[model samples]
Target chain A: MDSNGFRPEHRFDVELVAVTKRYGGTVAVDGVSLRIPRATYCCLLGPSGCGKTSTLRMIAGHEVISEGDVLIHDVNVTDLPPVQRGTAMMFQSYALFPHLNCLDNVAFSLKARGVPKPERHRRARDYLARVHLQDYAERLPGQLSGGQQQRVALARALITEPRILLLDEPLSALDPFLRGQVREELKRLQRELGITFIHVTHSQDEAMALADLMVIMEAGRIRQAGPPREIFERPADAFVARFIGGHNILRDGAGTIAVRADRCRLGIPEAGPHIRGRVAAVEYQGSSVRVALAVDGGPPLSVVMPDDRFFAGPVQPGEEAALTWSTRDAHALPDPA
Target chain B: MIGGGARSRDPREKRPWTFYALATLMGVFLLFLYGPMFVIYLLSFQGPNGGVTFPMVGVSTVWFEDILKPGQMANIPVAFGRSILLAAIVSTITVLVSVAAGLGFRRRFRGSGILFYLAVASLVMPSLLVGFGIGLGFQLFGWKADLFSSALAAQLTWTLPFGLFAMFAVFNRFNRAYEEAATDLGANAWQRLRWVTLPILLPGILGVAMGAFTLSYDEYARTTLVAGNRNTLPLEIYALISSSTSPTLFAIGTLTTTVSFLVIGATLAFVFRLQRRRALARHG
Candidate 1:
């Protein structure tokens, strides 16, 4: 039993067992399985059309599954409707009802369940207060800013008191500054509520920041799924290394290896087991400099160095440089089938 | 006015000659459109002795009073009642069917394209041809054509296409995210439609209602071919025109225009209030 005295059977709040979603002749989600632990933040990270959104929809019961089953808190909920599956979804557009004010939007589910007006409004106001939007209760969704609308959507989804909360690209619509703020708010909310959150996002930064379990998907399949640090340090394949950014994937004599850009040392030709290449371009990134190098028989490579170190011995564009990394820093990647 | 032939000046700083030309053209076009209606309104108040074309001897409500009396040629009150009842029925059916069809068209069914084109063809086809075809079909089926049956069908052919197209435009602007959000919030299909879809679309539905009412109210050519025994208001007015030449016809025209104005104005006022409330909600 958990500290909150929740049953052991309800430990994993959501599980997808070889779930698949097909649209006519097209396969959107191909035989994907996932397990989301209770009170954890799981992010489905992928590029557009990578089935992350489809998988999320299927879990929320918004999309019909063509094959396999979905288990929510140990219950077979594959055939259940969205409301019956004990899950609520926060849409990408923040889809707050334009006609209703913020309070009514949050209280919508309660009203649908036939909660009386006074009780529903009080509960909705409490949720509004939780999101710091109590003053804007009577205002329409359009009156609020994008970030504000997102808060209302979050509160609306939370009011349903679902075992699992699904978020579809929650931060994709926010500005960069507001995205960070809302990301922090989401983490705080999940921690407080102690409910599983399955969020879908294409942004590597967002997934890395908010996810306890970061799932990388590619072409309707999961390429890798693990903690953000483990995935970043050692991606499962070439796609995850490239998709997550800041990793240089290369074909060495042993096999494919991914080395962190910051971990590679830039020096003369005699600097250990090094690959020599001509510097194609140099980008100054405030804290560090990324030097892009072109090798004769391989793809382009990059090495990041601290700004002070780069200034000490900077290589100009079109100059020849040798790239080397510590053997321990090189993480081997599995072959893509 | 800005300087003439000053091509080298900044465009924003100077008013172009084309602006004045377009403004004058619009003014003349509006005058041409409403000039005949203005004359009809003025002549409706003509004295009892005055002719339909003409110079008024004195102003009085004698012609307006004549609209109430049942004349020997045609009864105006019963025909007016029929026109109103028919238009109300048409408006209700048009709103319901058009909304349902509009939602259906969002999902591409097998024969949706053919159905869409057929609606368009019905819209552009001559009104007289549509009425005649329906009238002929009814006759062959051994059915008696009436205002509600035959004439209503003819009007539907005209108004349904317009409502459908208008709804297409409305539903285009509608976001699917709202419906999905409703479902996520535990709303059933009926609740989602009632609370989200219909409320968002009320303004557009009102527009369709107003258009259907006006179109059916003034329609004559289509009804003429199908209206079997009784006459609608427009048909009765036509009969009056052929039977007499006096200020009474002008008065009838003026009264019909007033009714049209009152209904259209009331609908527009309600729509305006709805829009203003939405705007106010946003600002507050």
Candidate 2:
């Protein structure tokens, strides 16, 4: 907690200006700048260790700036501690205080911020009820199931009504089935509350579903930042195109062209504008079956299609197939390599 | 299922020598144990030399009664009270400080790794060494090395590391999402620490508290070195033994041993009950 720091009055949205955090000589985040709109659900989408969480932490005042300023509500709170900044963070692992029961956990911030006991309970109960965890108020975090505990955590954060809510992989811990449900619930809550939510996740699907504004990052750099449609349509670079969706990554011309599995048309070469390949393997996954193909000497490519449609008839185990995709769908990637 | 019919490696080949050796050594050690303590307990009750003599020359409770004279009897309550008070203060402080440190270190920071290593190094230092250092340091500050204050500080030094490590393990296993969720819900640092961190760390804190209390209660080396002339039970027992008093230190030993075990057992039971409740809640 730095004492000699700037404290700007609240009015502006969250902004990151030329932020740099280096782990030793290796720069985890190098000169990243971003501005999130007020009450927007923004996501820092990236691969593992891409400084998404670091950037989020810096904004939340958990991590100190190496060379930049973090402005919240338009005020420069670069050196203010998290508490004094009136910001809240949802940790990647949910770092809930395990000692408190669900209700007490929800009421923790209220109590610390000097809300009286009766009012604290009222506010906590309201948030808990919002997450549909009112009954588990007396239960400790360990006592609740993973999903239930997450709800308690959500309630805890929402009760504070901070200027901006920071979430670090908040839904990564749930079972896949529950992850979907929670993700939907989270999306719903964000819309209803309309508070600024800055979420950090490695999952592209999660970002795609939840982000109103998505910033795709890799190796501490923002490859692309835009609305979901714009990012998906015109991914600013090759990395953004490759990371945001499953890309049939391939060398095209002097640069590179990435075609999504769904976009890659699996038809005959006679149809034109298609790549000829031999079927390597087929994986059935309920709704979709991923068909792996070896394209000449190039890397193996995966083409995903609806299971019901792709397996309508017997496609030979080692047979050859023609793959085609529109040039519009083929994102131009940079030759960074 | 298809690979299940393959011939498995023989079970005997999987056995390790260390387990067998440990089991055999433990069996032999237990066999040789209880002989000396059993003899002392028997002798403490024996009439005159090993004879089962009556009141004058036989088995009697007179020695037990003699062991508790009015003066000694009064000292018992006072000494017990003091031990309890010291243990309570030391253990409580140990738990609180260690929990705070443990929670702090649980989160990653610039110098967190260095701090963790230093804490581990401190924990590894011998209790006598720490006691000597504290005692010397306190005296340098012109502070009298008393039972209450000096012993409290020394015991904290000896016990806090264990408490911290125990709590570190708790935080490591705890769900980070709960903390995150609390944070998302608007918990500030202290609020999150109080509501989420402390609740999850409760078992480890209590477990360490009980262990620290018992350790401080029976502690000898550091307590002896730093307590100056303070007369704790262990120190008192040591005095009677070296004074050629023939006092029943064995009886005191047995009582202290039982007290330690009881405290440990009670803590374990409490933790177990919490675990069971947690299990039941999950299932329900």
The candidate maximizing TM-score is 1
TM-score evaluated only on chain B, model 2: 0.78
Candidate 1 residues B102-169, lDDT tens each?
Answer: 99999999999999999889988988998999999999999999999999999999989999999999
Scoring each candidate complex against the real one, what DockQ results? Answer: 0.43, 0.28
lDDT scores of the candidates, listed in order: 0.89, 0.75
Compute each candidate's TM-score over C-alphas. Answer: 0.89, 0.77
Docking class of 2: acceptable
Instruction: Give per-residue lDDT, candidate 2, residue A91.
Output: 68
Best by DockQ: 1
Which ranges of candidate 1 are over 4 A from the true structure?
Answer: A1-8, A294-298, A335-337, B1-32, B42-74, B110-121, B137-144, B279-284
Segments in model 2 whose C-alpha atoms lie over 4 Å from true places: A1-12, A84-86, A251-255, A285-289, A305-314, A326-329, B1-21, B31-35, B38-60, B70-232, B235-239, B242-249, B262-284
Instruction: Give the DockQ (C-alpha) for candidate 1.
Output: 0.43
Cα lDDT tens digits, model 1, A37-91, are: 8788999999999999999999988888999999988778899889888899999
